[model samples]
Target chain A: MSFVQNFPFFSIILAMFSGIVSSVLSGKKARNLSLAMIVVTTALSAGTLAFCLKTGESYTYMMGHFPAPWGNEIRAGVLEGVTAVLFGVVMFLSVAGGMTHTAEDVEDSKLNLFYIMIDLMLSSLLALVYTNDLFTAYVFVEINTIAGCGLIMIRQKGRSMSAAIRYMIMSQLGSGLFLIGLSLLYDVTGHLLMSPAKESVELLVDSGSYRLPLLVIMAVVSVGLAIKSGLYPFHYWIPDTYGYATPTGSAVLSGLVSKGYIFLLIKIFYRVIGYENLVGAQMINVLYLFGVAGMVMGSVHAIQETDTRRMIAYSSVAQIGYIYMGIGLGTTAGMVAAVFHIFSHSATKALLFISAVGLYEVSGDRKDFVSLRGAAYRNPLAGIGFAIGALSMVGFPMLSGFISKLLFATSAFDSPSKMLPTLFVLAVSTTLNAIYFLRLVITLYSRRREGDKPLPPNPVKKSSRGLKFAIVCFIGLNLVLGMASQPIVQAITDGLAMFE
Target chain B: MDVSLVEHLLLNIEETVSIVLFGIGFTILLLHRNLIKKIMGMNIMDTATYLFLASKGYITGRAVPIVVDGIQDVSAYINPVPSGLVLTGIVVSVSTTALMLALTIRLYERYHSLDLDEILILAKEEEQI
Candidate 1:
């Protein structure tokens, strides 16, 4: 094996080891260590992506002496490489952007613990993307859950604490369902490694054996992941969890954490049960219906939300709905669209969250719509950043969101049964997105009313240079994804082809 | 409803019992108002899943998975993978339960209540204040 093939395994272990080491360091040192680790991982993953694209083949690295079905392994293909790169880049930018808020919101003594959680979170996300063993994925899923809870409640406020618990309960329920489904799948297929399991699944399907059990397993696992990803019916924990957490926590949780679960679900659909069998079982239709409902309902909820953070959180539900709807189309083109949307949404959402922090600082730390009037006048960079993010989300031309929407629309034409609803929801959801996000954009730039009482003097001295640099980089990332999406889409298509 | 279905369920009693237990635990988790009760429900659900997994690894008359008396036959012992998996599952559940309990303690200290609804109302009132 080439030395470059070891990058994925190295990245996971490095993040995990750094997490343990960061626990003992002082807060500032831990922050520096964590940032350095993320930067290194991003570089390594970029190298792996380059190697994979050049070689045009996927490779698996055995964890120990045992190989394949006998021992744990991590498989890195074009798709995993691209996902790891995107995750690493977005995670670094989110942490850098939200650093000021993290230091302010979390107590000084417990700051190291926050960085420790970030390291662990990054490790788990990479594992979720690259893991070849089903049981290993489950363990990392739990790790991701616990680390996410830690991130959410690190602010040490009553609201954040309550939100963390609610998130835990919902997350545990999802994992329980996932674990049981995995055990049942093992019982039927007698394999834990994904490739071997897929072989068994294909044989069982072809022979018409264990059909009912297979379908049930597929539904159970899909539902488990859907809940974890905050699908329409199971998103009760999202608003409080996202709104109450620190800015970094909100960005990472909303952008990377949920996407990690959905990516795992997509992997299971293609690698474990096989996509054809997934369609045959009619699970995609269920995902499709829920996706469409979430798209409309989540936006409606957002429209009614007065708090800016909560509105953004609700918009996440809508964005996740679009991804699931893409998957539910059950065509290769649809899958490609879904994967592309994952990248675009991660970049855009993280940008919005971090920029909201800047806007919040300028508005005397109030997050309500009314308090946010003329926020742009106070902080032009944040204002412009939020506007770019909002427009991208609203599918403006030459933005990442517009490209993903176009891909989804074109892909919908391939599936006759889903074509009309996909088009209808796409139209309605975009309009709804505009109603809230555009309004927020307009609110930020509008002058404060003359009749309103004069605001108290702002306590924050000035916005940090790190915050501005992070926002600028995020906007650059969004524009790149928007204006130059052809290469990324090509990469995604190649990765998915190598996936099976 | 069918007679043969009942007979089949009886034949696979361990699986049936575990499924029933899982359902009960899930229902409790969904319906329970108290924080501790919710944690207990999650634990019960986890235990039931372990039972299901353990039963899947058990054979009718196989020895425990060990090299005893130099017996090398594959069928001499039941599968050991699920047992290892169960051990991992137990460790994870213990940690999650500890975390939930820690968060519960924090909530109780802040709100002076263990009931979720009461705590939420108190929290909302606190936010307004």
Candidate 2:
């Protein structure tokens, strides 16, 4: 009832409020305001996480004094709190990390618009993470999608325009399906909040009324989110969209944007549908099969890519596969692995994209892997950052990816029937990951052979000191996450235990 | 055995009609070749979805959800939640339509054509160059 209990409420409202203010300002002022807003959000969310840990209680804050059934609400548990902090950190770093790229890539006149869209996107991501009401989630999801399209086409270049169109078409289809699914759900349960919906769904299932329709809705919602998140079979728009966007766009779209939807999916499965019914509906099997296929096929596609950014995009599809595979395992530990992978993938991919921009600048602005022969020699900071990201992606020991992969493998162990196939695909994906990422690492460090294009007469200007500091933080976080896995994993498991 | 199912679904003309509209809109969005046509299809799909949702909240003879004095029975009013949701959906769809048109205009400016295949071919040709 006090001010502190409303941390989740104010955190979301503050971000959304900043987004509105951001739209009216010049680009420079907007960036300053956004930075201040993000820092405040990060601090507040971290406070919320600490408070939740101390109290060991999850509570819901109702909107505008309306009761739960009538008005919207936000649930603040340790899981939601931690995810909000992650969203803040990633958004903050993404803009800070690619500051120069944004300046260079966006038209000077339209820079204000870019910052506005980024702020809106951040607010939407935070809202998506915190909102307890399904309809609120849908509204923010659209806001996120529109802001995403703006980020992609801020260039107004031919390639980015085409990419934006494709991205919008695919995303619109996904949201449309999501809307239909939510309509069916509301019709069935007559409740929009997760707990009441879960109760109604359980009763409906128990009585076996319209069981087939319920099953179909589950599949529809699952596939809808899968498509939007660029999981396999729905990832056709990903490489073009990520590859063509500016570095900051690439980082935010691939890293932070995708995770919000995945977070929603996890919440849906764990809280709204009830995990028992979710597993019983056989949706996980479909997700499992596609995830395995994505693991292999995504890597293969990455290997064939000529451009570095597109390769990273394809690799993202593969990483998403690992996350989905964990979710589809249908165990609490598995869900933790999936969520852990979400964090690791987000941090590592954003770092990779920003570093790739640094590599591009010194390589005569060529994004091709061949042109990056001696990038490290010119800019050791980006080179080292890229190496850290590559190592993590390949699941080297003592990194975040390894822990997520290990959690995934161990989690699958509980289901003996699924153990071998899951382990096999994971093992194969690891090898495939090494093949592409190590090749790039070797290319970065490889000597500038004579026949290759000469290094630019002068090295491109080094990235701003702020960007370097964020990269250092990224490396340190990845290393610390790897070394200190026990507390975090235990925390994740504990947080998930309190879900719903 | 299936009599009740058919009556519940097929006899509900509003639901069936809206669903049919959704299917048609989806087909147009997916299979159409023109950029403007795709936007139209998207609008149609939005309309269909709103119709479906609005129809879901309807009652046979219920009044509007506004409460007048002495109307104490909850059953006297239709559900208002779906209409509220559909209003938000309409706003989102309108914004989407506007963005799509802007994008289409940009594409038309670049390639001088509205056909999606023609634009794709032009893009591929440009890439080769």
Candidate 3:
């Protein structure tokens, strides 16, 4: 095996190890160690991406001495490599950008615990991306959920504490459903490894045996993942969970954590149960229906939201709706668009959260629309960052959101039955997206009223060079995703082609 | 409704029982107003899943999975994978239960109520104040 092939395994193990080591260290040391580990993993994943692109194939690595059927395995392809790299970049930016808030919001004693959770969260995300074993994916899903709950409650407020419990309950319910579904799948297929299971599933489908069981399994697994990712009907916990957490927590949870679950669902659809079978089961129709509902209702909720952070959180519901809509289109091109939307949404949402923090800082840590007026004048970089993120989310030309939107529109033509509803929702959702995001932008830049009382003097004047750097990099990342989307989409197409 | 369906259900009594238990646990989880009861409901749901998995691994007149005295035949043992999965599921459930209980403790300290609705109201009142 080439040395580059070891990168995925090494990165996952390194992240888990660092998480363990950080638990006992001081808070500052843990933070530094976590940052260093993120940088190293990003480089490693970039190397893997380059190697995979050159090889133009997927390779599976055994976790131990045993081979695939009897042992755990992780597979890496163009899709996994690109996703890992994107996750690493987004995570680093989110953590670095929200560093000031982390220091202030979390108490001194439990700070190292925060870094520990972050490290574990990253490890879980990477494992979810590369895992070829269904059981291993379930284990990592639990890790991600627990660590995410810890991140929410680490801020040590009553609101955050309560939100954590609500999050935990919903998440546990999702996992329980997922576990039951997985057990049923294993019972039917007699294999836990994805490839072997896929073979068994194909045989069963061809023989027309176990049809009802197969359909039930697909619905159960899809609903489990949909609930976890906060698709329309089950997203009641999002506003409080995202709105009350620390800035980094909000960014990472909304940007990467939910996307991880969706990626796993995509893998299950393509790799485990074959997309054609899923379509036959009519699960895609259900997803498409919910996706359309979520698109309109999420935006409507956002319009009704009074708080700025909560508004952004509601927008996330809408963005997730768009991704599911793409997936529900049930074509290769549609899946490609869905995957690309994952990337664009991650970049733009993380940027918005981090920049919103900067705005909050200038406005004396209040997130209300009234207090945010003219706050951008004090922090021009943050103001500009917010503008770029908002505009990208609004699907402006030469922005990442626009590219994904275009991909969705073009791909919708492939399916005649889904075409009209897809286009109609696209038009309606885009208008709704514009109304809320642009309103926030205007609120940020609007001048303070002459009759309003003067704001309190700013307290701490610490230099936020790290925050500025992260914002600039995020903006650059968004632009690159928008302008150079062709290659990435091609990469995703190649990756999905190799998926089976 | 049909005789053959009843016969099949009876033959797979363990699976039927487990499914019924799962339904009960899920309903309790959804309907309970107290935080402790909700956690209890979650644990019950987890236990039902473990029961289901364990039933799948067991076979009639089969020995435990371990090899006994140079007997390496596959027929000598029940399927071992489901048992292993059940063990892992138990560990995860324990940890999740512990985490949920800890959060409940904190919430009680803050609101002095074990009822979710009461706590939510108290929290909103605190926010306004």
lDDT string, candidate 1, A1-500, tens digits: 89999999999999999999998999999999999999999899998999999999898889999977899989999999999999999999999998988999999999999999999999999999999999999999999999999999899888898899999999999999999999999999999999999999999999999999999899989999998999998999999999999999999999999999999999999999999999888999999999999999999999999999999999999999999999999999999999999999999999999999999888788889888899988999999999999999999988899999999999999999889989999999999999999999999999999876555686334678888988999999999999999999999999999879
What's the best-to-worst order under DockQ?
Answer: 1, 3, 2
- Maximum-lDDT candidate: 1
Candidate 2 clash pair list: none
Off by over 4 Å in 1: A459-461
Across residues A214-330, which tens digit of lDDT does each residue of candidate 3 receive? 998999899889989999988988988999999999999999999999999999998989999998888999999999899999999999998999999999999999999999999
DockQ each candidate and list the results.
0.81, 0.62, 0.74
Q: Give the candidates in order of lDDT, highest first.
A: 1, 3, 2
* Model 2 Cα lDDT, one tens digit per residue, A56-165: 87778888878878788888788888888888888888888877778888877778788888878888888888788898999999999999999999986777888898
Candidate 3 reference-contact recovery: 0.50
lDDT (CA) per prediction: 0.93, 0.86, 0.92
In model 2, the runs with Cα more than 4 Å from the true position are: A454-459, B1-6, B68-72, B124-129
- DockQ-wise, the better of 1 and 3 is 1
Error of model 1, residue A486, in angstroms = 0.4
For model 2, the docking class works out as medium
Which of the two candidates, 2 or 3, achieves a greater lDDT against the reference?
3
Candidate 2 lDDT, tens digit per residue, B12-125? 888788878877877787779888888888888789889988999999899999877779789899999999999999999999989989999999999999987787678767
